[model samples]
Each structure stands twice: as C-alpha cells, then as structure tokens.
Target: MLNFLKKKAALIWAGNHVKKTQDFKLNAEIKQEEQLLMMVRTAEKTLFGRQHHFEDIHSIEDFQERVPVTDYEGLRAFIEKMKKGQRNILWTDTPLYFAKTSGTTSGSKYIPISKEGMPFQLAGAQSALFHYIAKKGNADFVNGKMIFLQGSPELEEVYGIKTGRLSGIVAHHIPSYLQKNRLPSWETNMIDDWEAKVNQIAVETEKENMTLISGIPPWLIMYFEKLIERNGKKITQLFPNLQLIVTGGVNYEPYREKMNELLGGKVDIIQTFPASEGFFAFQDDYLQEGLLLLTNHGIFYEFIPLEEYGKPNASRLTLKDVELHKDYALILTTNSGLWGYSIGDVVRFISKNPHRIMVSGRTKHYTSAFGEHVIAFEVEEALKSTVAELAAQITEFHLAPQVNPTEGLPYHEWFVEFEKEPEDLNLFSLKLDDEMRKRNTYYDDLITGNVLQPLKITRLSRNAFHEYAKAAGKLGGQNKIPRLANDRTIADILSEYKI
Candidate 1:
C-alpha cells in the first residue's frame, strides 16, 4: 500500500510537469522574448551592477564588453574565496553541493550547485520527457522505474554534516516515493567505492523491473558488458520491461552501435546534457536531431561565437536572437548562483521554433595540430562510417594527433580494437582516410598537401583499449578515454601503455 501511494504521488507530479510544459510550448515565442529581457536584467543586477558598462546594454555586443570571459581558472579562484568563508563574488550562501567534472586537461573543478537551483535542473529533464511523449504519442511512462547510473552519494563531512557532489545532491531531491526500494542505497556511499556498488547493483537489479536507465555512456557501457559477461544472453532477461535508455557525461556516438547490440536493440535511446552547473538541454523524441532548450526555466542562456572567444571585439547572443545552424560557445547564468559562467562546451543551433540546440563538443576537445580542425563528433562519425564500410566490429577506439616534421604533415593516429583482423589493414586505413576527407573539407585540403597527410589506423586486440582504461583507473563508471586531444600533453598521457 505504501509503495502504491508513492507511485501515485510520483505520477501526479509527472502529470503536473507535463501540463506546465504544454502551456510553455504554446507560448514559446513570447515567453522566449520575455525571458530574454528578464535574463538581461538579472545579468545587469548580478554580473554588472550599477556601472554604466552594465547599464544600457541593450545588445549582445554591449553585454560582452561589460562581462569579461572566464574559464575554469577564474572559477577556481571564486571557489577558493568561498572555501575560506569569505563573501563570494557570486553567491551568498554555503552551497548544498559541489559537482565534480572529469579533468582530462586539468585538475577536477568542484562546482557549487545550490539546492534552490535544483528545480530548474529537474524541470529541464522533465521537459525533455514532455517533448518525447508528445512525439511518441505516449504519456504512460510517468509511472515507470528510472534507473540513474550516476556517481555514488558519499563525500567528506564538514562541521559534522554530510554533503556530496551535485549529481548526488540532485539524486537526494528525487521524490522518495519514486525511488526503488530494492536498488542499492546511495545515501551513504562514495563514487570511489565502485567495485562494491557495482556488485550490489548487479545483485539487486537482477530482480527489479527497471524501465529507464541513465548514466555516463562509458560507465553504463562497462556495466552492460559486465552483465553480458556474467549472465550471457540472459542479461536483458533481468529487465523485461525496459523502455528507454538515457546516457550522457561523455560522447555516446562512438559506442552507440555497440550499446544497441548489447541491449538487444529493443529500447529507445536518448542523450542529455546535464552538468553540475545546470541541466542545459536534452534530446527529445526527434532522436536524430538536437535538444530543445528549456528557455523559460530558472536558467538564462548566452552564446559566444566559437571562433571569437578571446577576441577583444567578440559578441554574445541571448536565446531570443541566436541564429540557426551557426556554432557558438555556450555561456550560462543560472539561478543556481553561477553568474555569466562559461561551462566550456560548444554547441550549434538546430531549430529556432522550439529553441532546439545540439552539443558539438567541448572547447578543448579538438585537434588543430596541423591547422586542420577536427572535432570529437566528426571523428566519431568518420569512425562509425569507416567501420560500417569495413564490416568490422569495433569494441573501443581513441584518436591521437601525430605531427611528422619530416613530411611536414599532421595526421590522426587511431588506436582501435576489432573482433577480427580485416583482410587488408592498409586498405582499411585508406578507407578511413577517404571517409574523413569526404566528411571534413579541412582533411581533404590536408590530403592534397595544402595542410596535412592522410589519417592512420592501428588495430588493437579486442577489449584492449577497455583493459587499458581499466588499468589506468578510468574504466567502468564515469571515467572515459579522451576522444580528441588538442595538445601533445594529453596525447602523451593517452599513448602511455601503463596507467
């Protein structure tokens, strides 16, 4: 009876959120404009103050001049100030959680995400569901089990009080009645305690009827692999009613085919962009396209032209004025207390009617070693196409840039694992090179000697890269191999055979 009541309450809440989303969609254009003005006013009051630079800033260009660009270093300084109990330049209260992100290029940043700011994040996720339901003509998923494959919820205590990173804190905000009674308890564990927790989840979920699954793609992929290894083809037998699988935190494009094969190709897959800063956006039912922005929520959106980040005359755009099909670096000011924060990911606008966008890749996750800018997404696409053409089954792969001084050409070195060796390795490598040239003009120019040479491919043993990541402490939950390295430093680290 208790479980039934809890499920009922959860359904009611979901219905309310859906209703609100429908109303918002009906008034999207007007609401978007209104929200833009309100956000400008908020930015003036918080980020700019009464100074003339902050005032009378009617255009995106003017706003750019008033606020200087900030990276993780600047954010670190702000966090340090708060740690010493000093009045922070941003927020006044002690934050409820500090979300940790993977620090491949630098040390991990502990970003503060407050409790009052959580509702918007939750709403962003819910709105994605609303869009999905509308597209699929099904609203019956409100009562389904949602399994978030998130980090464990344990952290160091301060002043005899317990706190954790943002993901854990948000997990706590999940309505108690909606939570699975049979799942392993996250209230008292740290993410570092993975082995025990993985075992626990494996045991408990064996009997539970899970419907929704969420987590970083790499980790979830590892979990599914473990299940397959342990239970054989009986893995899906555990969750007979599974409907949707949601993944993020890292690129899912590379692992999509493999993941679908593992899950028996029965469930619908969706990707989301939920970060410690806020829930940015999510892929709705239009699974092949972009995510619709939650424009009127507690968050305000801004965009900097990707090519003009450090320029003195760089401009920014609000949600009301951004152009479709143009790539822009994202800057966000949220009710979560992050004012004019640059969260470091770049994205492109896909649609203007519903304010939909797609994450391109991170600002640093690109290779320009030979002046041929190849992003992570593009590389993943090229790999996917190449593998399909070769009829090869790739388990895992990584791309590293190699500069050849003798040839004066820069090329990508692909370390890939396959089920069986292709008949002709050289032909396979050339095919991948041809695919890259076809996809990217820059690579085509590089091949013609205007920029660089053709891309190279080296085959590794099946599960070789996975084993390497496991040995390096990046395997399983939340740890992912770097997809595109901008500099030789990360390249060196990835090239290392040992952890």
Candidate 2:
C-alpha cells in the first residue's frame, strides 16, 4: 500500500510538472520578457542593479547598453565580496550558499546560490524525469533505484558561505521522498577519491534493482566499467531493468557507442545542459537535435553572435530575436543575481517555436590559432565518426594546439586514453583528421595548402589523465578533462608523463 501510494504520488507530480512545462512552451517569449523585467525590479536596489541603473531600464537595448558583457573574471570582485558575507552586492541578500566549480585560470570558482535561485536547478532535474515519464509513459523507474553518479555532498565554508561542487550541493539537497530511491548513499558520495567511490558504489548497487542512471558521460562510463569488471558480466546482467541513461556535462556522441556496448543494449539517452551558473536547458523531444530552453525558469537570457564575439562592441540579443543555425555565445541575467554574465558557453537555436537550442561549445574552448577554427562539437563529431568506423573505445581524452616554432607547421594535438584502442592507430588518426577536414572548410584549406600539419594523436599510457587529475586534486565530483585548449599546458604536461 505504501509503495503504491509513493508511486501514485510521483506519477501525479510528474504529470503536473509536464503540464507546467508545456504551458511554459506556449508563453515562453512573453513569459521570458516578463521574467527579465521582474529580475530588474526585484534586484533594482542591489549594488550591481543600482550601478547599472536597473530601475531606469525600460527596454532590452537599454539594459544591454548600461551593462557591458561580463565573464567570471569581470565579476570576480563582486563574487569575492559576496564570499566575505557582503550583502546586496549582486543579489539583494547575502547568498545562502555558494556553488564552486572548476575554472580555467582560477582553479575553482565560487558562484552565489540564492534561496529563490536554487529552485531553477531543481526544476530542471524534476522536469527532465517528468518529461521522460510522460513521453515514454513509463513510471516503473520511479519505484526502482536511480543511480546519479555525482559529487560528494560534503562542503567547505567559503568565508561563511557554504561551497562545494555544484553536484555535491545538489546531491545534498535532493528531496527526502526521492532520497529513498537514490544511490549510492551520502556516505559513499562523501568519499573524495572518484576511483575508490566508484568501487564502493559498484559493491553497494550491484544488487539493487536500478532502473535509472544519470551522470556526466565519462564518469558514468567509469562506473559501468567498474561494475562490469567486478561482476564479470554486462551491466544489464546485474540490473536488467535499466531503461534510461541520461547524460550531460560533456559531449555524449563519442561515448555513446561504448556506453551502449556496456549496457549490452540501446537504452534511452537524454541530454541536459545544466551548469553551475544555471540549469539552462534539457532535452524534451524524441529527435534529440535540440534541448527545450527553460525560458520561464527565473532566468533571463541573451545571445551574442559568435562572429561578433570579442569585438570592440558586439551586439547582444534577447530571446525576442534569435535566429536558427547561427552560433551565439549565451549570456544570462538570472535570479541568482548574475547580470549580463557570459557563462563561457556557445549555443545555436534550432527551433524558435518551442525555443529549442543545441550547445555548440565554449567561447574559450576552441582552436583558432591558425585561423582553422574548430569547436568542441566539430571535434567530438569528427572523433565520433572516426571511432565508430574504427570500433575504438576511449577512456578519456584532451586536445591542445601545438605551435612551437621548431615543431614544423602548427597542428592540433590529441592525448587520448583508450579502453579499447583501435586496430590500426595511424588510420584511426587519419580518419579523425579526415572527418574534421570534412566538417570545417578552413581546416581543410589550411591542410590542403600545406599551411598546417595534420591533427596528431598520442595514445596515452593508461590512466595518464587520471593521474594528472589526482595530482591536481580534482580526482572526483564533476571534474572533467578539458576537451579543447588554446595552448600546450595540458598537452605538454602529458608529454612529460611516463607509463
């Protein structure tokens, strides 16, 4: 009777959430504009708001004019002040919590998480599952265990504000009712080392009737690898009812074949674009070409054309006017007190009716040193095509631009750790190069004209990246290999690494 009630309640909530999301899709444009106005009104008295003359902003153009485009570095002073308990700096009140995430230059970033703003992230989580349940008409997963491979819930005080990996903080805040169906335990999640935690999770969950699994692609793959190794059988053999495999945090294309192979069958894969800054988008339709932009979810968004990026004065557009197919750098003016903030991600709209978008890459996460610009999507797509053709399995990988004066023509360098290395490595590299050249005309022209060297591959002696992560103290919990870098920092470090 209790189980029945729990399942019934979950279905009801899921139904309600699904309907709510549908409503959001209908009024997304007007609703988003209204949200933008509300954020300005509510935060108009705050330091950032007052300084930017938020109260005087009657239009999007005015808002854009008053507030210059800002990145994490640009907002560091205010963030640092917030860490020391400064009130009414960005948001109206002191941040109840601070979400810390890995930074390219700063090592880690502390983002203010307000009480009202926390729900933005939670709404995305619930909506993803609810949409899945509603679309598939399957609620059995609600009764079964959900294994979210995420960070430990443990947090440290960042100048009196609670701070930790966004995953950890979210994990610790999972609603109590849902907690009954989630694993591994808080104790296991608290384990700092990722490898050890995976082993522990495998031991604990190998016997559970898990029906849902959600995580970043690479870590989820690691967990599957450990579970299969420990039980000496397919993951399905251990939990045959597993029906959903939701992933985010990194490109899933290259990892899909291997993850599917581990499951021993094709499981439903849902993509979400949740980040430390905000839970921005989630996959809604069956085609999976784009994610439903959560436009009404207390976040006001803007987009800057990729071509106009880093210009002396680039144009920024609100959702009221974004075109399909053209890449744009995403900007946010959120309920979290972030105003005119560039989260470093780039995306392109695919559907304006429902406001669906595809995350392309980061503004900084591209290689254009030689004018042969290539983004993460291009790299991952190239790798996905090549790896599929070669039947190669990857554990982890990183890429960097190599432009040493004496090292011949500049080339893109790949440091890959393979679970199953390809049969012919040279051909594997060539196929990867060929795929990129096909996707990017500039890259093709550079190579065709002998102005650039072909993309190079260095298959790392196992666990090379892992060892580096451990040494860097990022062994677990939302840590990811930087897929593309502008310089040779990571590549050079790996070059000196021994087997």
RMSD of every candidate to native, in Å, equals 3.7, 2.0
Mark the regions of model 2 whose C-alpha exceeds 4 Å error after superposition.
Answer: 1-9, 405-408, 497-499
TM-score computed on alpha carbons, candidate 2: 0.95
Query: Measured by TM-score, how close is model 1 to the native structure?
Result: 0.86
The models' CA-based lDDT, in order, is 0.66, 0.84
Candidate 2 lDDT, 314-377, residue by residue in tens: 8888776888988899999888888888998899899988899888888988888888768888
TM-score of each: 0.86, 0.95
Clashes of each: 2, 0
The lDDT of model 1 is 0.66
Give the Å error, residue 403, model 2. Answer: 2.0
Q: lDDT, candidate 2, residue 269?
A: 81
Screening candidate 1 with a backbone cut-off below 3 angstroms (N, C-alpha, C), the clashing residue pairs are 149-214, 446-452
RMSD of 2: 2.0
Stretches of candidate 1 off by over 4 Å are 1-16, 22-62, 102-106, 137-145, 157-163, 187-191, 286-288, 405-409, 419-423, 471-473, 493-499
